[model samples]
Target: MPELKKQSQVPSQEDFARAKSKSRQFDEIAGRVREAVLDEFRERAPISSVWLFPGQDGDLNGYVFYFATSDVADSLESGLSDEIEKALVRKSKELIGSGCSVIFDSHESVVRKCNGNYFQYLR
Candidate 1:
Protein backbone atom coordinates (compact mmCIF):
# COMPACT_ATOMS: atom_id res chain seq x y z
CA MET A 1 0.00 0.00 0.00
CA PRO A 2 1.16 3.50 -0.81
CA GLU A 3 1.54 5.99 2.04
CA LEU A 4 -0.92 8.94 2.03
CA LYS A 5 0.46 12.44 2.15
CA LYS A 6 -1.24 15.23 3.95
CA GLN A 7 -1.29 18.99 3.35
CA SER A 8 -1.97 21.91 5.72
CA GLN A 9 -5.70 22.41 6.24
CA VAL A 10 -5.24 26.16 6.62
CA PRO A 11 -2.55 28.59 5.56
CA SER A 12 -0.34 30.12 8.31
CA GLN A 13 0.29 33.77 9.10
CA GLU A 14 3.67 33.57 7.39
CA ASP A 15 1.96 32.31 4.24
CA PHE A 16 -0.48 35.21 4.39
CA ALA A 17 2.40 37.67 4.81
CA ARG A 18 4.26 36.18 1.89
CA ALA A 19 1.18 36.39 -0.33
CA LYS A 20 0.55 39.97 0.72
CA SER A 21 4.11 40.91 -0.06
CA LYS A 22 3.91 39.33 -3.49
CA SER A 23 0.65 41.16 -4.26
CA ARG A 24 2.15 44.46 -3.14
CA GLN A 25 5.20 43.86 -5.28
CA PHE A 26 3.06 43.11 -8.31
CA ASP A 27 0.90 46.20 -7.73
CA GLU A 28 3.99 48.39 -7.38
CA ILE A 29 5.41 47.17 -10.63
CA ALA A 30 2.10 47.52 -12.46
CA GLY A 31 1.49 50.97 -11.03
CA ARG A 32 4.89 52.16 -12.13
CA VAL A 33 4.33 50.92 -15.63
CA ARG A 34 0.87 52.47 -15.80
CA GLU A 35 2.18 55.81 -14.61
CA ALA A 36 5.06 55.81 -17.03
CA VAL A 37 2.83 54.99 -19.98
CA LEU A 38 0.18 57.50 -18.98
CA ASP A 39 2.81 60.20 -18.65
CA GLU A 40 4.20 59.40 -22.04
CA PHE A 41 0.82 59.32 -23.78
CA ARG A 42 -0.59 62.41 -22.13
CA GLU A 43 1.97 64.44 -24.02
CA ARG A 44 0.49 63.61 -27.42
CA ALA A 45 -2.52 61.32 -27.10
CA PRO A 46 -5.97 61.64 -25.60
CA ILE A 47 -5.29 59.04 -22.98
CA SER A 48 -8.14 58.28 -20.58
CA SER A 49 -6.45 55.50 -18.66
CA VAL A 50 -3.58 53.07 -18.57
CA TRP A 51 -3.49 49.58 -17.15
CA LEU A 52 -1.00 46.81 -16.60
CA PHE A 53 -2.30 43.26 -16.94
CA PRO A 54 -0.46 40.52 -15.18
CA GLY A 55 1.67 38.49 -17.51
CA GLN A 56 1.49 34.75 -18.18
CA ASP A 57 2.52 32.36 -15.43
CA GLY A 58 2.04 34.91 -12.62
CA ASP A 59 4.37 37.52 -14.09
CA LEU A 60 3.35 41.14 -14.11
CA ASN A 61 3.96 42.13 -17.73
CA GLY A 62 0.97 43.10 -19.82
CA TYR A 63 -0.45 46.55 -20.59
CA VAL A 64 -3.56 48.12 -22.06
CA PHE A 65 -4.65 51.74 -22.52
CA TYR A 66 -7.88 53.52 -23.38
CA PHE A 67 -8.63 56.82 -25.08
CA ALA A 68 -10.90 59.58 -23.85
CA THR A 69 -13.20 61.19 -26.37
CA SER A 70 -13.39 64.94 -26.10
CA ASP A 71 -16.49 65.33 -28.25
CA VAL A 72 -18.63 63.20 -30.53
CA ALA A 73 -16.43 64.02 -33.50
CA ASP A 74 -13.33 63.55 -31.46
CA SER A 75 -14.79 60.33 -30.19
CA LEU A 76 -15.37 59.15 -33.68
CA GLU A 77 -11.87 60.03 -34.70
CA SER A 78 -10.25 58.62 -31.63
CA GLY A 79 -12.41 55.55 -31.73
CA LEU A 80 -11.38 55.11 -35.31
CA SER A 81 -7.81 54.80 -34.07
CA ASP A 82 -6.86 57.93 -35.99
CA GLU A 83 -5.45 60.19 -33.30
CA ILE A 84 -3.59 57.57 -31.29
CA GLU A 85 -2.46 55.15 -33.93
CA LYS A 86 0.65 57.06 -34.81
CA ALA A 87 1.66 57.54 -31.23
CA LEU A 88 0.92 54.00 -30.11
CA VAL A 89 2.67 52.41 -33.04
CA ARG A 90 5.61 54.69 -32.56
CA LYS A 91 5.80 54.01 -28.84
CA SER A 92 5.30 50.26 -28.98
CA LYS A 93 8.99 49.60 -28.58
CA GLU A 94 9.35 52.06 -25.76
CA LEU A 95 6.32 50.71 -23.89
CA ILE A 96 7.44 47.13 -24.35
CA GLY A 97 10.77 48.11 -22.87
CA SER A 98 9.02 48.21 -19.51
CA GLY A 99 8.83 44.39 -19.74
CA CYS A 100 5.20 44.18 -20.89
CA SER A 101 3.25 44.07 -24.12
CA VAL A 102 1.30 47.27 -24.79
CA ILE A 103 -2.17 47.77 -26.28
CA PHE A 104 -3.93 50.88 -27.54
CA ASP A 105 -7.71 50.62 -27.25
CA SER A 106 -8.74 53.35 -29.62
CA HIS A 107 -12.22 51.86 -29.77
CA GLU A 108 -12.17 51.97 -33.52
CA SER A 109 -14.28 48.94 -34.14
CA VAL A 110 -16.68 49.99 -31.46
CA VAL A 111 -17.25 53.25 -33.26
CA ARG A 112 -17.65 51.40 -36.51
CA LYS A 113 -20.36 49.28 -34.99
CA CYS A 114 -22.23 52.45 -34.14
CA ASN A 115 -22.25 53.20 -37.84
CA GLY A 116 -23.39 49.63 -38.51
CA ASN A 117 -19.97 48.57 -39.70
CA TYR A 118 -17.86 45.78 -38.25
CA PHE A 119 -14.61 46.59 -39.94
CA GLN A 120 -11.57 48.68 -39.26
CA TYR A 121 -12.29 52.38 -39.51
CA LEU A 122 -9.36 53.84 -41.32
CA ARG A 123 -8.72 57.47 -40.70
Candidate 2:
Protein backbone atom coordinates (compact mmCIF):
# COMPACT_ATOMS: atom_id res chain seq x y z
CA MET A 1 0.00 0.00 0.00
CA PRO A 2 1.19 3.50 -0.77
CA GLU A 3 1.64 6.01 2.01
CA LEU A 4 -1.14 8.52 1.79
CA LYS A 5 -0.02 12.12 1.35
CA LYS A 6 0.09 14.41 4.34
CA GLN A 7 -0.88 18.11 4.67
CA SER A 8 -4.32 16.88 3.62
CA GLN A 9 -7.35 17.10 5.83
CA VAL A 10 -10.75 15.69 5.09
CA PRO A 11 -13.68 18.03 5.58
CA SER A 12 -16.05 17.50 8.42
CA GLN A 13 -19.86 17.62 8.36
CA GLU A 14 -19.80 21.24 9.43
CA ASP A 15 -17.26 22.09 6.81
CA PHE A 16 -19.37 20.53 4.08
CA ALA A 17 -22.51 22.35 5.15
CA ARG A 18 -20.66 25.63 5.46
CA ALA A 19 -19.08 25.19 2.06
CA LYS A 20 -22.48 24.50 0.52
CA SER A 21 -24.05 27.54 2.10
CA LYS A 22 -21.15 29.77 1.21
CA SER A 23 -20.32 28.13 -2.06
CA ARG A 24 -19.97 31.38 -3.94
CA GLN A 25 -17.31 32.74 -1.63
CA PHE A 26 -15.26 29.61 -1.96
CA ASP A 27 -15.70 29.52 -5.72
CA GLU A 28 -14.49 33.09 -6.02
CA ILE A 29 -11.33 32.31 -4.13
CA ALA A 30 -10.76 28.99 -5.84
CA GLY A 31 -11.30 30.47 -9.28
CA ARG A 32 -8.17 32.51 -8.85
CA VAL A 33 -6.16 29.60 -7.49
CA ARG A 34 -7.10 27.52 -10.51
CA GLU A 35 -4.70 29.55 -12.61
CA ALA A 36 -1.82 28.61 -10.35
CA VAL A 37 -2.55 24.90 -10.64
CA LEU A 38 -2.93 25.14 -14.38
CA ASP A 39 0.35 26.97 -14.67
CA GLU A 40 2.10 23.98 -13.14
CA PHE A 41 0.11 21.02 -14.47
CA ARG A 42 -1.39 22.33 -17.65
CA GLU A 43 -2.26 19.49 -20.06
CA ARG A 44 -1.35 17.09 -17.31
CA ALA A 45 -3.98 16.95 -14.59
CA PRO A 46 -7.58 17.96 -14.89
CA ILE A 47 -8.38 19.77 -11.68
CA SER A 48 -11.72 19.17 -10.03
CA SER A 49 -11.80 21.95 -7.41
CA VAL A 50 -9.76 24.04 -4.98
CA TRP A 51 -11.02 25.38 -1.68
CA LEU A 52 -9.63 26.89 1.47
CA PHE A 53 -8.95 24.25 4.07
CA PRO A 54 -10.01 25.70 7.42
CA GLY A 55 -7.39 24.41 9.78
CA GLN A 56 -7.73 23.19 13.36
CA ASP A 57 -5.61 26.16 14.38
CA GLY A 58 -8.42 28.45 13.25
CA ASP A 59 -6.49 29.55 10.19
CA LEU A 60 -6.28 28.59 6.56
CA ASN A 61 -3.36 26.23 6.10
CA GLY A 62 -3.87 26.04 2.38
CA TYR A 63 -6.24 24.44 -0.11
CA VAL A 64 -7.23 20.95 -1.29
CA PHE A 65 -7.40 20.23 -5.02
CA TYR A 66 -8.98 17.07 -6.36
CA PHE A 67 -7.95 15.76 -9.75
CA ALA A 68 -10.43 14.61 -12.34
CA THR A 69 -8.19 11.88 -13.67
CA SER A 70 -9.33 8.51 -14.94
CA ASP A 71 -6.66 6.38 -13.30
CA VAL A 72 -5.32 7.74 -10.01
CA ALA A 73 -2.55 5.14 -9.83
CA ASP A 74 -1.27 5.60 -13.37
CA SER A 75 -1.65 9.36 -13.25
CA LEU A 76 0.83 9.42 -10.40
CA GLU A 77 3.32 7.09 -12.09
CA SER A 78 5.58 10.00 -12.96
CA GLY A 79 6.00 10.59 -9.22
CA LEU A 80 6.35 14.32 -9.69
CA SER A 81 5.66 14.89 -6.03
CA ASP A 82 8.60 17.22 -5.52
CA GLU A 83 7.78 19.40 -8.47
CA ILE A 84 4.10 19.51 -7.62
CA GLU A 85 4.71 20.42 -3.99
CA LYS A 86 7.17 23.11 -4.95
CA ALA A 87 4.76 24.61 -7.41
CA LEU A 88 1.93 24.62 -4.92
CA VAL A 89 4.01 26.10 -2.14
CA ARG A 90 5.58 28.72 -4.36
CA LYS A 91 2.25 29.78 -5.82
CA SER A 92 0.33 29.60 -2.58
CA LYS A 93 2.97 31.30 -0.50
CA GLU A 94 3.21 34.02 -3.08
CA LEU A 95 -0.50 34.58 -2.68
CA ILE A 96 -0.91 33.97 1.06
CA GLY A 97 2.12 32.20 2.46
CA SER A 98 0.24 28.89 2.35
CA GLY A 99 0.94 25.49 0.80
CA CYS A 100 -1.37 22.92 -0.79
CA SER A 101 -2.16 19.24 -1.11
CA VAL A 102 -3.33 17.40 -4.21
CA ILE A 103 -5.99 14.78 -3.78
CA PHE A 104 -6.14 11.67 -6.00
CA ASP A 105 -9.75 10.65 -5.53
CA SER A 106 -12.51 8.71 -7.22
CA HIS A 107 -16.13 9.61 -7.79
CA GLU A 108 -17.09 7.14 -5.12
CA SER A 109 -15.08 8.98 -2.49
CA VAL A 110 -16.17 12.50 -3.41
CA VAL A 111 -19.22 12.65 -5.69
CA ARG A 112 -21.06 9.64 -4.28
CA LYS A 113 -20.62 10.97 -0.81
CA CYS A 114 -21.17 14.70 -1.43
CA ASN A 115 -23.64 14.35 -4.32
CA GLY A 116 -21.47 16.72 -6.36
CA ASN A 117 -18.57 19.10 -6.06
CA TYR A 118 -19.44 22.58 -4.79
CA PHE A 119 -17.38 24.39 -7.40
CA GLN A 120 -19.28 22.72 -10.26
CA TYR A 121 -22.47 24.21 -8.92
CA LEU A 122 -20.92 27.66 -8.89
CA ARG A 123 -18.24 27.91 -11.63
TM-score of each: 0.51, 0.49
TM-score of 2: 0.49
lDDT of 1 by residue, 7-119 (tens): 87899999999999977876775566566656765665555555555566443333233443343255346564343443343443354433344444544434644552323
The CA-based lDDT of model 2 is what? 0.55
Please state every model's RMSD to the true fold in angstroms. 8.6, 13.8
- What are the lDDT figures for the candidates, one per model? 0.50, 0.55
lDDT of 2 by residue, 8-120 (tens): 49898999988787767645555566577666676665444445554454334443344543534545676553455566666656654455554445443466556666545
